[model samples]
Target: MNEFPRMSVRDTFARDWYLFRLDLLLAGMPNKKVAEIRKDLRIELAQAAQDGEFRQALAGLGPVNVLASNYLEAHGRKVPRVWAGLVAFAVLLYGWLLGVISLIEGLYSAADQIRPDATVEVVRNWLFVQARVVAGPEGVDSIGFSLSGWGLLGWLAVLVIVPLICASVWRAWLPRPTADQAQRA
Candidate 1:
């Protein structure tokens, strides 16, 4: 039998971390492979624990642990096909929400153009009528608000900038692995 290489504290922690993610990826795979990988990782973790290094390494990996836990909880029960379908459904739902909001705004604008006395009730009724035509019985009365040109521009800016900010924050939180670390995995 081939013996695995002895791993230092840091190396062991990194290995275990990667293996945990791998296990999640392979959750629905064969039990034999999962057990084998878990056994190996436990052995490494045990050795690191004997030297008090496992706790230290785990302290440094708090963020990674949180991320991994969230990922597994969100995705573990889902196969790739189901995961993709769920994502598509979410996207479609979001688009529909935006379309409905846009349509309501458009109706309010149209009502304002036609009836100078475009009270909130007029906009609400107009939206309800148009929504009934498009969305049938599912349509409900919605509150509406108007945006000034600057306010609309500000909203647009937020829509574009929020994702960029989130991407930057994510990149900062998880630094790129060094070349050697990448190769080790």
Candidate 2:
């Protein structure tokens, strides 16, 4: 009375690989939707295996990313893309760093106006920007500035950069441009 469904090593491997890639592509999707997808995929894999067209079935489904995107779009979900977000974050952070370096340099140049005897010196590299404003003859009343305030960058990441990248890359809030619209631009 021991009856279990059987699958060959090749079928098992193919099924596992397909599911694994699908899982990765569908990460951050809602759990209910994921479960539904898993169930559907399992049934589809079994049918494909029974028909001896498992590989063709997988191929017909197309790339996992595209399949996942279709599934998500079918469900009306707008998921943020990790690669797009990362690229946006990197570019924004670099810009912020440049701005910080420039501000530090400006402050250093204007140090003399803050105090008659103030002297400015760069104490750290541009990437991890830092400077000191010595306002007294013997290093007294010294002021320091650095890339210490990450809140601006953090806010940009959360509020502006990531969202813009997601929207633009995925066309989340915009309809796909028609061929005529593209030609006009």
Candidate 3:
């Protein structure tokens, strides 16, 4: 019974700390920034535990939600809202574009699996039947279709550039400071 209670308390302490860490993350601070805050907390907790004041330390940290809000209030404003929003939008758009590409590739794979012997004529005819082009306001007077190497290259360039641009923006908005800078601070 004594051992069971001790184990329970230990588990609760760990669980609480994990919840605190996640709450910090939920405050919209970047992962690296949250980790830095959590690291300091863990150090404090360890010191308290060494002094047999673990429970006191936990109480001192206060409610996880409140602590997170305070943390965001203090540190989250380093990045401007417009820049952060733009970075988030770019990331989401990049993800959506990747999903669209994946879906198209999956469909093409399935089609290939279904008809391995399909010729260019079959694929072209299928495209002609499915794809519709409208030239005027409502409908096109005529439909013409062409697939070229340059078109494929253009798509590939977009696929590569979109993610690169998003990554650059994300980094700019939430830069992971170097170890030297962190330590100096």
Candidate 4:
């Protein structure tokens, strides 16, 4: 009997995790073809596992991004990385919010320092949002925050940052060059 040694649970887990991530990154691929490729990969992985080279085999396949790109290119499909784009959008939105908050806080603190209890109005009116930090002799009396409209900077941000994000997502969407091609470039 020529029985191959079974892989340890850790090794099995490592292989399974890699394949699972590969499966996720292979989105936009034809289900049947994707299944076929995954099946074939499993067979190859099984052989490598018997030799206790499971991790190395997984690494040899390359990063999930490049591997997915290769498969996608072979199938003649250029699928946009929708998930990544969405994530980027979310991060930008939240980051901008944080920036606005910090700006308002700093302005208020500065005013408080210059005129501790004096009547002061710190208004930062942007294209769409208008923020007013008012302080009376008794310190900060009221905080006024409103969404007026998209300011010039807001439009500029949309124009500049948005295209850059799209270009980035698209660039990431496109197939990556092989190591040799990259070296040459």
lDDT to native, each model: 0.50, 0.64, 0.53, 0.72
Better of 1 and 4 by TM-score: 4
For candidate 1, list the clashing residue pairs, or say none.
Answer: none
RMSD of each: 14.5, 9.4, 11.5, 7.9
lDDT of 1: 0.50
Clash pairs, candidate 2, are: none
Each candidate's clash count: 0, 0, 0, 6
User: What's the TM-score of every candidate structure?
Assistant: 0.38, 0.46, 0.35, 0.54
Instruction: Give the C-alpha miss distance for residue 58 in model 1, angstroms.
Output: 6.5
User: Candidate 1's error at 122, in angstroms?
Assistant: 6.2
lDDT of 2 by residue, 5-100 (tens): 566898888888888888877755666778888888888877887777878887888988899888766655446355465567677667866776
Candidate 4 accuracy as lDDT = 0.72
Residue 78, candidate 4: C-alpha displacement in angstroms: 2.8
Model 4 lowest lDDT segment of ten: 176-185
lDDT of 3 by residue, 77-146 (tens): 3433334445555675577556555544544544444443323212222211222222332222333344
RMSD of 4: 7.9
Please, what are the lDDT tens digits per residue for candidate 1 over residues 63-173?
A: 644544443344332232223434444564476467767777676555444443223344332211233112212232344445446655664565455555554454355
